[model samples]
Target: MPLLDPALWSGKASIGTWTPPTGGTAPVVEPATGDVLDVIGVATAEDVQVAAGRAARAQPAWARLPYTERAAVLRRAGDLFTEHAEEIRQWLIREAGSIPGKASFETVTAAQECYEAAALVSRPLGEVLPSAEPRLSLARRVPAGVVGVIAPFNVPLVLGIRSVAPALALGNAVLLKPDLRTAVSGGVAVMRVFEEAGLPEDVLHLLPGGAATGAALVSAPQVRVISFTGSTAAGRKVGAAAAEHLKRAHLELGGNSALIVLPDADLERAASTAAWGSFFHQGQVCMTTGRHLVHASIADEYVERLAHKAAQLPVGNPDKEEVALGPVIDAGQRDKIHALVTASVDGGARLAAGGTYRDLFYRPTVLTGVTDASPAYAEEVFGPVAPVRTFTDLDEAVALASATPYGLSLGILTADVMRGLELAERIPTGLVHINDQTVNDEAVAPFGGVAGSGTGARFGGAANIEAFTETRWITARSAQAPYPF
Candidate 1:
């Protein structure tokens, strides 16, 4: 298949594409082959203003439409996405370097999000509260007007759609700024679906560019809400910019999540889940489990199991179905991962498996005997590296798990139900998985982090809808009593 032409995709819409700022066009490269996929047009401050103006004009009409009618449009979009899943999957593989399986899963996840949002919108926002007097009181959940969505490159389809679907379903207009790396693939695929479903051109806009474009969207006065998913440092900057305008912002930032393996846990299962979570997407996920805290009684055995499993993951072209692992997003990320591993090794951590970077592909790495002071344990190693530490008991394990500044997601592998529940309550993260790894993300569950991990929530059905909306209280009394105020 030929690479998608941005001009052609934008031409399909009535509103048309925003032209690049002077001398601002940049190449979008495929990580695997180092090939230039396309030259994406960058947006300027004026471009953001124009997009926001168009959204403001279209939002009221969209909000006025009945929930069922709005849902129908989204449902049609889901169908369109399913029809073109393969093409989108290939694009994701080339641009984002997502393995074939992961790419396909992302597309499916995006489609499922659209269908789920449609179903959620059909239900009433709130129920009436009974009152002693002959009056009515109810809560109405309403949109927050124009929203700015700044999505990350990793898991672009899933993360971006998860935010955009709910915002649109709740009757808000969205101006999306996808990461410059995978903009053509993820951005164009989503815009095509929404446009084909008869979404008003003004209601949805795709502004593809680099940091300047993102800053423009966050700093725009007309943007009422900003939803961002990226590093903690970048999230802080975006948060500060949004605060200047006093716009509501939702951030899903960095995570150095830990996976705890208890004494009674199944070693095989823990090993497999740990390998999958740490290596999947080359550890680019914010919620990827980078730290493993295992009970000392079984720590050595579990580390050996993880090493064996890590060696089995095939590192090759993302387009190959059998390739379990692929390259990191780019060479810069590869270098970062490499440096972290080198520092860990120098700090007395034992390298149990892979630790070398071949171009964009970093070998699946496994480390043991790491300390809390080591960077690998303290920071978010966003690569295919797993650092393991030993704990004598549950209390020690919990302490190690909570040591990091991030509290996004964590996992505990234990057969005992009571122990699992106890740990789940004590853990500070937003989501906890029992008998699994940190990579487990469900569309129906509330998936956001606590502390530096993030603020606000995504998924968990109605909670997501609530995140994209504001609540208003409506109270009614007899008309004769209206003068009392």
Candidate 2:
């Protein structure tokens, strides 16, 4: 069949095994135009149970395959993603509200992630260790059986694949639960790639539904690990539920990240960076620069320049116009973003640029004169809103940045790279950029956050060794000699 032909998926539930859904069906609506794209089944708790059982049964043989054979499958999957990039790009634009550039980027990144995961298979998996007794000892890495991946709507393709590809590459079966709004791009597309790449039947299950499905996946007895990417509030619940089952949950959660511009930095360059960091993908990113901390001496010029950049960028339906930003996921998200802006303005922050939206198309907004009391300044807006604050010195900048419980990503721009590095040490964030924006990702870099942002279960390169695998100690003796008895 053609890639993601609407008729092919209509009334079907999963990308694996072609089983009918037990939780009924949901219409796939395009948020930008309010058009029903297709109809897909919504999986229920019972479906999760069945998927878990299938995964448990299928995992052993898959794991027993030769490492080279497994790696070859992943390599083929990567190539398939590139070969079908245009088709995947279209789905991302229509289903996830991604701009053309963003859609293209996702396809490239998805292929890169799969390639990286392919390489992971041949990496040194175990190490020899010293033993006191006359025996050979070793420490080995093994897959956590039946991994459960729960991904979000924003950046669906990258977020889902980052976990799914690596977990499967490590010889674990996966049960993925993607948010309903962008299920086709996030869940179904992934299933198709692995399926065509020749993954064994029942090794991966795609469950698309609401909270009930996610909860079922998290708490399933057969699910040994959970990989979740979403809000902090929901992440906390996932963590708790997984703990109740004594399983680990890898969480890459929310953030109200900051971008600090020192007085010595280039104003024009800094302004451009700030605008991209806060407004790219409509600021619906975990590492979005929610707070802009500029030195007081250069704050006015920076705000003015940043506001101009935000205003110059166009916003509309990506399918129709050439725009820098497209509509958010839905109406509820738009309302929440506007309400935060209104609260920030009511609390004394000045609207430096945009503060209005049409339907789901929220304008890129900038704010000045913000304080700790401003809601948008203090909260994770998850919209195209940038709230700026002025700091007199490095001490005040550090103080302001550290005030939030979130410690995800921090960016600092300055002429003196050494001083920027020095300042970064004082902050508690997981990732830092000396002279770049906060919204950055690579298939090779270890990406995640700290504190409320997540459990610090990073995904990428060598980090995957720890995220998806468990360490075991094994010993071999020449013979079974004498016992105490």
Steric clash pairs (candidate 1): 445-460
Q: Indicate which candidate wins on TM-score.
A: 2
The TM-score obtained by model 2 is 0.99
Give stretches of model 2 more than 4 Å off: none
* Residue range 119-178, candidate 1, lDDT tens digits: 878778876887776788888888888888889899988888888888898899998888
TM-scores for candidates 1 onward, in order: 0.94, 0.99
Inter-residue clash pairs, candidate 2: none
Backbone-clash count (model 2):
0
lDDT of 1: 0.83
Q: Which runs of model 1 end up more than 4 angstroms from their true locations? A: 1-23, 129-135, 477-485
Estimate, for each residue in 299-349, the C-alpha lDDT of model 2 and write its tens digit: 999999999999999999998999999999999999999999999998888
- Best by the lDDT measure: 2
